[model samples]
Target: MNRYQVATAELASSQKSGAGVPAYLRWVNRGLGRRAAAVAYVAGLSPNAVTLISGMLSVGGMVVLVFLPMSALSAVAAMVLFLAGYALDSADGQLARLTNRGSIAGEWLDHVVDSLRLPLVHLAIALCLWRAGLPDWSVVVALLFLVLSSSWFFAQTLAGKLSAKAADDGSAAEGTPDWVSFAKIPYDVGTLYVVVAALAYPPLFLVLYTGLFVVTAAVAAASLRRKYRALLAEQRDYAPEN
Candidate 1:
């Protein structure tokens, strides 16, 4: 098979095996991903196009966050837009599957957009908290988790970018990898917690911090552990014979 097929197979296999996604996450991902797949097939949008749509939906969610309280209505709107963004996130891959339009460039765009959303959203949340004169600790903790999560994402993205570059240049790639060997951790944990957060507190904003931070920490730990073992395996030289 060609590189495109090879890459796609790797991803699809990783997904099917739940190699790096938390088991509990499968509950939401199964449904959202399937729905995204359906929309992608019907809409004929490319993965990059889907990524752009996801970013736009997220910004729209941010707009709502700024204008409204963390009330039931606002929570619902934010949840809708957030899910829309996530649907787009899932759709990108599904579109690639349907149209055979997947590419390193498409993957690159998806990761870039996904990475940006967390920081920007956290900044928006912090701003809202400041505006409402809530205790500084919540926003501070959220931002801290956001930073940790962002750093982990950058590491993963850089790994992918390097892998793409290496494939372009015909060499080995660098940077931390996309998964922790066999341990699955869902990259979309923020959206995963949205419903739970909304349900758990009087205001949706209240639960966002603990939920995101704890999950981020778990994913990061899993990621680092995987990278360590993968490195060891990679370093062991395999001498081929005739």
Candidate 2:
């Protein structure tokens, strides 16, 4: 294979099968990520370099939203930057795999970018809405939404830890629901689209936001329960005689 094909194939090998992506958006993101990875690989860019650019663009987009006055044109620009950042986020992992230089540090840094970007986007939007002179209650809603969404990430971390313990004990915890992951796309990879759509129609966006929040909140609770239950089961397996 040529370099481009080689790079794309490497990405395919390393990539998950749309783990958290909605069905409709999966193909688009996959194509964008692979293409970007190919281009970055051909350009001899390191994975960390791609990651740094992604972080800068994503964070800078939020900075625009929170610090500047809201406007349709500005919102569109922010969405473009955020989407580019996300596409590059995908490319970084693929590039890492292609270079055989994937490391724990790179993984942690990628996640750190995501961890910050997710909550900050919500906070930025909340502040933007406040600056737009929306009610104080709307800002409160935004903050609450941010808290619930960030909690979901913490729940996933807990689940990962419990899964590791369960695996060590040879107890297979139940498989995670695909739809739960799909439902979270609006809050993650799909955030730019969500924000753009919301910016176009504020009242409708509130309803949709509430719906997403409810679904994700439910999924987080379910995930946490499963993880905690598995942890208890592991304890029981190792428990001493009464």
Candidate 3:
């Protein structure tokens, strides 16, 4: 087999469980990431390098959104950059696993970038809306989105770590229905980027963005409660007997 083919095979074998992953991530972003990771592998690039590249691309998209005039072309450009960065975001971890160079530091860097970028994207949207002379409530919606998105990210990450620590098998309960992934489309970053691409049309963007925020907030509320309760149960189960 050719080197690229060999790299692809290796990455395919090392993929993490897809349970509960959104369809955009499972079906779209990860597929693009696998291709990018294979290319990175062939070029002998490190995972950290790939991660930095992803960050740069995302930042570039935000810059375009905040600085460039709102236009269909500009929206498309920013959307493309954001989507590419997200795909690369997935690529870095796959590359790390493929190269066996995964480290705590690398994972920390990835999460840090993600945590910052998620909020910043919404902030950029708010700025763009303010510049466009949209109503104050639209700007308010954007800021609220920033808050909700970051909070969800923090809670989800914390719950995963806590769950792993509390469980003996290092596994959360299984039997997540396959349809849950489809239901999570509204929560996907890819979906957000697609909504952000509607920036050219203020009315459309506001309607869609607000709708996404509502759906996300509802999902986050229910999911957070479930996670908190699950963690509490796990903690009680593992407590030392008197």
**Per-residue CA lDDT of candidate 3, range 54-109, in tens?**
98999999999899999998898889999999999999999988888999999999
User: What is the overall TM-score of model 1 with all chains considered together?
Assistant: 0.69
lDDT of each: 0.62, 0.71, 0.87
Question: What are the per-residue Cα lDDT tens digits for candidate 2 across 1-242?
Answer: 89998878877777665544554346566678788989998998888889889889888888877776666777777788788888888878877877898998998888888788777877887887788787787778778878976776766665565567532322222454567555556545465444544654566666766666667667557766766777787785664659
What's the distance in Å from true for residue 225, model 1? 5.3
Residue 43 displacement in candidate 2 (angstroms): 1.9
Which parts of model 2 have CA positions greater than 4 angstroms off? 19-21, 165-188, 191-193, 237-242
- Model 3 Cα displacement at 206 (Å)? 0.9
Backbone clash count for every predicted candidate, in the order shown: 4, 0, 0
Alpha-carbon lDDT of model 1? 0.62
Against the true structure, whose lDDT is highest? 3
C-alpha lDDT of residue 109 in model 2: 88
Clashing pairs in 1: 20-184, 20-185, 21-184, 21-185
Which candidate number maximizes TM-score? 3
